[model samples]
Target: MSNPFSYPTTPHVRKHGPAGYREWENYRPWLRDEFDFRCVYCLCREKWGRRRSSWVVEHLVPREKAQHLALEYSNLVYACSSCNSAKSAKWVPDPCQHAYGQLVYVTNDGKIHAKNADGRKFIRTLALDEDDLTNYREMWLHILQSWKKHEPERYRQCMSFPDNLPDLTQKIPPNNTKPEGANNCCYQQRKQNKLPEIYG
Candidate 1:
């Protein structure tokens, strides 16, 4: 489902880079397009944010185990900030903590595939087939359907939360850049801080 062409390579990553960096350079846009920039796990739209960077490129098998299979498109996917971070460098789950062994990474057709038993355990431990995430998938499905029905209003709403009137308003002025610059692209900071300017 990956579109091989749209991927971009960073200069540093093009030379000497970690597997994560290389995989992200060549694989991110492809996966983003394939999955519509939605989290492969939670099904939420993602943006590149500061604070250690969000929306990480997740590998089913930790890089060490994936050396031979690193380029396998099916083995790579996009994960949300929390999910990817929580899974840091792990190839699989701790089975002793969860029953039912581990759920193998299945392709779109739902075939069992895994690099090791630990991977299976990781899946099981995390409840990778979580009902919450499934519900999120359905939520994204509804959003897609709704977007097609009404573009203008939906687009406005989508541009509202996480963003706001001031950020992109015409009143911002010509030749004037964002008051706080790129890192402040979203109002997430205000929202996160529960600032009076945003909440009040």
Candidate 2:
């Protein structure tokens, strides 16, 4: 996308010791609410399958360079566990000595494009292009596209829900008639997260 704000810094609660867990707890809910529990990188929503879900917090930058920014809400993203580990502390990849432009930051305008080596490497390193990952991403894109196409009115309604995907995923269907293979990865993970309860 375009320029976006940096992650919000949290200096007050992340002191040290056992309180670190508290810091995680403090940030998780707010961040999850903000991103609506969707993995920012792939936009894997609960309504979508969770096969690609890391279901963990991701730092836009490596934690080392921006440790102080750990709890910053803007720096955080709901990501599949794989993305978090793949991202590992190396937010960007090797720079060509004279590369220009700012590193990609996931703020309001952060689009999921890898423009530089570091960015591309991160994707490859994390296997973001893997079959499974691509499937989830493509599925979500289809949902977004479908909304834009045939169901304009309902699409507006979905957007109106704010955390539409997450909310929808959380809702459980009353019947047991899932699409044959729907019981696979994504749906299984969604059920684990109590998603069926949130969306039907």
**Tens digit per residue, CA lDDT, model 2, 1-200:** 11112221222121111113326445454345445455554444543445634377677666789787675544555666766676676653222221212322232222334556665665566656666655544555455457758877654544332332332233333322332322332334455664333220
Q: For model 2, what is the error of residue 100's alpha carbon versus the real structure, in angstroms, after optimal superposition?
A: 14
Model 1 RMSD to the real structure? 14.8
Q: Pairing residues by index, what is the TM-score of model 2? A: 0.46
Best by lDDT: 2
> Which residue runs does candidate 1 get wrong by more than 4 Å?
1-23, 47-53, 89-200
- For model 1, what is the error of residue 56's alpha carbon versus the real structure, in angstroms, after optimal superposition? 1.7
Error (Å) of candidate 2 at residue 39 is: 2.2
* Predicted structure 1: lDDT: 0.42
- What lDDT does each candidate get? 0.42, 0.45
RMSD of each: 14.8, 13.7
